[model samples]
Target chain A: MDRNFPQELLETIQKADRAGAQAVIDAWAVGRPFHRVIPELLSPTLETFGRLWASGKDGVSLAEGYVAAKVAEDVLSRVLLDASGDGTPRPSSKGPVLVGNVEDDFHPLGRKMVAAFLRADGWEVHDLGVDVGPAQFVDRAEETGARVIGASAMMFTTAKNVAKLREEIDRRGLGNRVQLAVGGAVFKLRPELVAAFGGDGTAASALEASALFARLARRASEARGEVPA
Target chain B: MNSLERVLAALQNRSSDRPALLLNAGLYGARLTGAALKDHYRDPEVFAEGQIAVREAFQPDLLVSPFALAGLGAAFGSRLSESSRRPPNVAAFAADSAEAALRLPLPDVDSHPQVGYLRDSIRILAKRYAGEVPVIGLLASPLDLPPLIIGLEAWFDALLFQPETARALLDHLTPFFVALGRAMLHDGATALALTANLANRSILPAPVVERLGRPSLEQALAEIPGPVILHHGGCPLLPHLADFKGLPNTVGYVVDAGEDLAAARAALGPGPLLLGNLPGPTLGDLSPEDIGALCDRALSRRAADLQFILATCGADIPLDTPADRLEAIADRVHRAGRVEA
Candidate 1:
């Protein structure tokens, strides 16, 4: 609960170090951004805890895992506020990107984490939340003039919607207009599966995806002979 | 001993030395191992080969669907993307509307492309070994449908915040699900695995699960007219188990590892057969020798009861669960002094 803790929370989260980040998380767990912190920081941290429990450690318990996740969620919700509004201006020339879960998938923890990371990197991101249909994605992309679209789904059942988006893009003749990136638990198991839906690329992790989308958007501009903005 | 006798004896609460295998032939195996379905539709030989492999390997007493729960939702209108590894996924729900819900009619098992594939797979399995192994069809509990329609967040919000709308949507969706179950039963599924994750404690609030899920499940259970086998993952559904017990044709209940079997026995009380609560991480990831040792611990700790059937709490079998390890779990179960052969 040190005042200096949250300043390092994002950095600590990036390192994926649970012990290094726990004090910050425990301090911010009940403060705000619980969902965001849980998956981004707490869940991954507890993932280590889970491994320990599985390996016959006697001290750790599921309750500890739950507490860690809840606290992380709180910090996530709190830190998420004013991030976009208070965001430092876009220092990069790449176009803005929109990310979200498709209409059927409800798991937003992953998507929110990605958004937080992107916001910190100075990309104005519109997170459409979970379960937006194909039309919603197209409408949001066009409205925002977004050159890159990112979608996340944890279940294989919902991951199929990525292909539907591709079909929608082709129907609208926007194939050349935007690049699509897909990620999530399903994609983690099979990165190649994203191509079945015709995405430009797939990210297996938050960092890889944020970097991939920026590069893809820049490349899309270059293909048009525009200087890489 | 054959699987049927082993399973039947176990169900009867008699002691048995012959192990009873009950492996699922779903995408979990294909997902974990990166194996393909070989054929998703109209290939009897492909279906036969996969079934034969499982039959020879596990010699399981009961055969459950090899596909994921999202298959039915996908066949109608959901975007189902398959992977070489992991189960097929739906990117999102159709939308939160009665019209959207109705637009995706329950794909008739005999006609829908994926359902046709499953049915063909079943026919092949049955034809190849009818009396030897009973085939159980997996159906999503109606509570699961609302989430697919409105999205999980919206559905949860509806359950917690807007009770009336949730009730209305559930009222409409429940019967169609029952009809699907009846169709599968007619297609030769001796047992039905009803997965109501939305109703499970992992996701749904206990009171909401009781209020929204219990009634529809009760109706579906009555309509399906077969032994219903209920499953949940992550969170225990002890509060909802009473509702399952109250259903008319309920023959068995599967308590996940999230649940305490001793508590489940106390809740359901000795009539319906209890299957599962085998944690996959514990059972599937260890070596045969290590797993066998853990299996001994698991049996001694729980499942050493008259009414327990052997099964995983949920199906996410690790890729490393060797055929021999699979056999060892069964062998250990058979060797349990209380288990009947």
Candidate 2:
């Protein structure tokens, strides 16, 4: 399979032309497995756009990057439905995970990106939505029996409150049962913040987040003395 | 020469004893007073008192207004989250859609309590500091304000796909920018810090910004009584400096923390003062010596450029940023600047 998407599709997304991007995805995705299509095609496109957003290069805008992400998300959703009998996701090899922005952090862009990447990577993500409090995160994780909790905060002030997730998990005596994974622009800017804020781990980008979650998920399983999925 | 003079000298690209130092200590001022962060934000009197404490302690060249977006957002019916632990953030967008936002009324800066809260803070700080220091008034640029009014995603969709709808919102916000900014200047703010996030190249391509962002900024800056300082507003600035050049009343820019200060100064040319590249909220995590070293690096990067001010970049500095961290910065630059020992 060709690793590179058509340059036309790249240009289309850069123009924020949603229909053109969708059409490209429809064509390129033909005869491709959802797993291979996601890991090989979509993730690379996202990483490219993510670089554009990070570098602030001429002619590229975040609007264009947002278009690419939305297209990636759309293809994933459609693939899931086609694979499942009733839109219920086909059984995943991995455990479910929870993701949300910490309480008072209305910045949902980063968290939403993380959700899409996780979903694409085969994790059933229970997105708690923005402005989610610490209790809500732990409670949802407990109810879902999810082992890894990903919390996002864009600002340092909000990032400080990410610790509350750790505090809540410990208070419930789920310290060994549940693991905390944190991220956002702030964490990337200050790599030390992940450890300082009590996150068990962090990833640099949405694509990297899936790998980080996998590692933490393994640790949680081992602590619980369960066989790895 | 005092703080105000040092800032003025930097604005004019004139040589001074050293570069002007602006802490951009957004709400760390409130933290200095030991007031509940929420109370410090809520009560104008508390906010004023806090800035005074910040001033007494650090003697920064500029006093920035509080997160004016939260208060000014109320003009469009936006509400604030109630947080005792940290300063409150906007709990809800004023309008969920761009069309809904356009229908909202433009604020009367003289009477709107939310607008008045910001104006009063600047007034108090400006009045007290008087000729001693410059108070930078915060005014969200027309392109940037819509995201605060309507949510970011909705605004982005409107801006990219529905050009007319976004234009209408920009048209509506431009007047508010002018009015609030003029009022701040009237109240004694030496300059208006035009926080232009949407103007950043990363957010909108240069042509889009030229078509959508520049005209509103051109008009607003021309309308405001004081000179404007173009801030990165949480995004990088150096790449797009050309789009902002030659606007009326624009005196400088606040470089993004991740950007190279020397490059920003070079791109901006010798015309406008460049202030920034320090991460404001991360100051609390660093030692005084580290902060001083970063300050020294910023200074050396400029390498004798008189048109510069050392400042913390991004939307704000953390509230718990230790006083000693700030003092360390002041000891680095403020002590070396113009006439006073």
Deviation in Å, model 2, residue A32 alpha carbon: 8.2
Candidate 2's residue-wise lDDT over B1-341, tens digit each?
78888778777767677777787766776677778876777677888888788778877778878765766676778887766555566778888899888889887888888888888888888888898988888878887787777877888888777889988888778888887787888999898887777866677755567787788678777887778888888776777788887888888888788588777766777788888877777787789999888988887777577877888888667766777888888898864543322
> Model 1 lDDT vs. the true structure?
0.62
Q: Report clashes for each candidate as comma-separated counts.
A: 46, 0
In terms of docking quality, model 1 is incorrect
Query: How far out, in Å, is residue A182 in model 1?
Result: 16
Lowest lDDT block of 10, candidate 1 chain B: B26-35
Per-residue lDDT over A1-229 for candidate 2, one digit per residue giving the tens place of the 0 to 100 score:
5545756566777887778778877777778655456666676776666565556454666666566667768868777777675554453647799999998787887788788778876788999988898999998998999999999998888888888888999999988679999988788778888888899999866656778899999889888889554
Candidate 1 local lDDT, residue A64: 31
User: Would you give the TM-score of chain B in model 2?
Assistant: 0.94
Q: Which candidate has the top score in lDDT?
A: 2
* Residue-by-residue lDDT tens digits, candidate 1, B1-341: 56666666666776555435455545334433344544432354564565566656655577765545666666557666554444555555566554456455556655777666666666666666666777777777778776545555556545655668777777767776787777767767767777766655445444555676677667667777777777764445565576567576777787765466677778888677777656553354457887677567657665456556666655555444556667777677767665332
Give the poorly placed runs of model 2, Cα more than 4 Å off.
Answer: A1-7, A28-61, A80-93, A171-173, B205-207, B300-303, B337-341
DockQ of 1: 0.05
Model 1 lDDT per residue over A1-229, tens place: 3464444554443333335566676665566544355345544443454354335343332223223343354444445553455662223434578998975676675686567556544467888987778889989988998878898887555677888988887788878567888887667655767787787887645644557787778766665566554
iRMSD, model 2, in Å: 2.0
